[model samples]
Target: MTTSKKRKREIDDTQRVSFALSDQPVTQLGPVLAHFPSIKPTKSTSFKCYKTQTQKPMIDNEDMPFAEIPMLVAGETEAVDFYSSEETRRGSLGSRYFVGVHNKRTGITTLRAAPLHILTHEVKALKGLQPAAVSTLQRLEARAALGETFGTKKAKLAIRAQERNKVDISAMEGVADHLQESILKNTSTLPSKEEAKASADSTRLIPQYDIDALNSSDIYPLHNMIPKPEWKALSISAYMSAGGGAERVALLPFKRSNWINDHLAIAFASPSPNKTAIKMLIYISTMIAFHKATFKDINKEVIQQKLPMVPSVVIDGLLSRFTETARGSIEARRTPEKGTMLLTHMFALCLHVDDFATDTSVLAADLSMEPAKVNMLFKTLGCKVNKLTQSDLKRLGLPDSAGEVKRAILKTPLEFPKPRTRRRA
Candidate 1:
């Protein structure tokens, strides 16, 4: 007599888990469930699970909520990047609305960010559109520290959450910019309605400043160029000076810095940096006027000529903190206001010099220097010029062909020594 055996109900099919596509282990086990049969899981709308996942205080399966997963439809990339899991399962949603994801087994929630039907990483939009929590070790450490009790130092960081979800009107322009950038970034065949609308609205929000208005002396005409208060604050920090003192003189008027420390370190104070940046900008405009370089109206030739002048100010400002150029122009890429000013100068220069080109042989004539001297100057400034072809010349804005050239060419050929007199000819 043999007893019939019953296998307890086994979870034979794959259950969703809160894992990113790149690291999800679901695919590796696909072969086990192959050929058995696949019954698609309904989105389970109007169900307890969906409501529980989206609950404010979090429910039992909070860990695997629709909001916590990353996309992982292994072969389907379209489904991965642009579509949401909810949209694919139940179909498209209305404007400014989306249904996220949740894992039944683990009870965690995550955002459904798949493009079409492919799987990708899921993220939770922290309430109020604050920074998507960066799960960095440094951040984790700081967060943990916040929970700890403090002693005499009494460290406290009060974070005030918004009362309501208000569209930041002032940041509408920035949001519009972000939306436009998002559209440009998306290279898919068909964009979602939300994406299209965002792109359109962003285009409308970012006001275009007229080039003529920017050139004009009148401010009212160029009112369109107004940026946010933050931008205004940044403009003040166009340059920065160092703080703290170096012996004898606590804060000297920037002596050339040595290896010990820099000449002027940027102060992070808003509106303006410490004395260094203020003095630096004043110094630059003053010096340029002192040298008296030809300017055919700054507003007209705003982009090219003046822009190039910016790197000088950036270089000088950095030097004010230190004696020597450190890390080359790496530091210049940062320092926001100085960077913007430099860009303006570049724009101005482009405006002034139409069809302006440079050639080593030609540069010698303008500077009244030998070819060797010109080469030396260019090389010291980290420029590379080609011996043949015209790549380097093009960078100098020089023409490719001699006949079709627009700008004047100035060259200093190597001088030839006279041959010994043939019996005093």
Candidate 2:
């Protein structure tokens, strides 16, 4: 087993250094370097930015491209090393970027540090660092990992055994009959009746919902149609709305609503007092106020931060629900067909999977759905969850490396359920 370190000072890897640089050297400017044309250019007093410009070819109308900075003598690595070796304020732009001075005649390039924006961007730490997991496990882990237990070897062993299998054990059932006598001998060390009574009485069972106990958020009603940008980016399903007017709007896929409401806050801001949108706003707002208090895991704190026109996802659900529940009529009508149960169910999958609704079942049993059923659903809905082939992806013109979320909504084997129509009001 040999390492590169064994072949130390490997000179062959170093690029051949040009022998043209005199005692007075050239400086490199932004990607290009200032260079002499044919013979070295006459000295000028003007503010010469060290970067180079192309010179016309000696022959035809064609102009030759300027020489690029050499990788070994003067590119990203050399720039980085030079900055690292310098004794100055750490991580300055001068440490990173350089103006290049190229000498076409001598075939040499010199790099000089230049002031530039060593741009800093607030790149959120990517989520993949942890891998995709549902919220249920995240919460369960949070509790179990942080939970406190009595410091006892017996307790630790019991937990380990429970993890292996949920079972009850009796010492004498498997072990020696002498274990019973050992236990009897230790009975005298047990706590008194008062201690036992005190422990039993410590737990109180009472329910209280104070005025202050309200959860969820306060927000205006959301539009019945999948309102644009309210929930931020709508999923690929948004285009599913193919009918003419608002009826087409109702068919926008399940992911849009689920992502906003289940993933975020849902508020219902009212429209004008007499308007249906207003009524929707009121109903959703009230529902949000109720659900936030009851639902186990929403970030209610995030729900309250107000946006311009739309309520957060928290409130959006309520508004949509209220309109559906109220029956297409605020004044007098039937369901306007803003959305469908199938659409809702698809998004529900996202919310449930994210909340880890399926995790327990997956852990206990099998997660893979019946392939027959999946194929049937695809046949019924005329869609694909994973058309897992390079050619199919090329046909769609979608990138081969689309995200899980994209795959979830686009590639999902969802059937467009037959639309139900109401008797004309």
Q: Using TM-score as the measure, which candidate wins?
A: 2
Residue 322, candidate 1: Cα error in Å is 13
**Please, what are the lDDT tens digits per residue for candidate 1 over residues 1-425?**
98769867766445544542323332222110111022332333111111213426543433543433223232112222111234333332332222345677764455333222322222233324745433333463565465444522333322112213434455465665677557656855577877775464334311232322332222112122222331233233323333333431222222222210231332233455444333333333322331222222222133224334233443343224212223754322223333333322322221122212224554344333477655543332222333423653565544556424323221222111222456755
State TM-scores per candidate.
0.15, 0.17
Residue 296 of model 2: what lDDT?
37
Residue-level lDDT of model 2, residues 1-425, one tens digit each, is: 96676655655423444533233323323332232222222243122223323364353212322222221111122112111112212334234545556666555676554443121112134423754433433454454444425436765676566557833344334343355547756996788977865453332111111212222110101222233343343222322223432432233222122322322222122221223322222223333232333233333344344222224563455344423334463431113232222223232232222321111122111213454443333323223344335654555444757322223222222223343579998
State the C-alpha lDDT per candidate.
0.33, 0.33
- Cα lDDT, model 2, residue 341: 26
Candidate 2 Cα errors over 4 Å, as ranges:
1-225, 229-314, 322-381, 385-387, 393-425
Backbone clashes for every candidate come to 75, 34
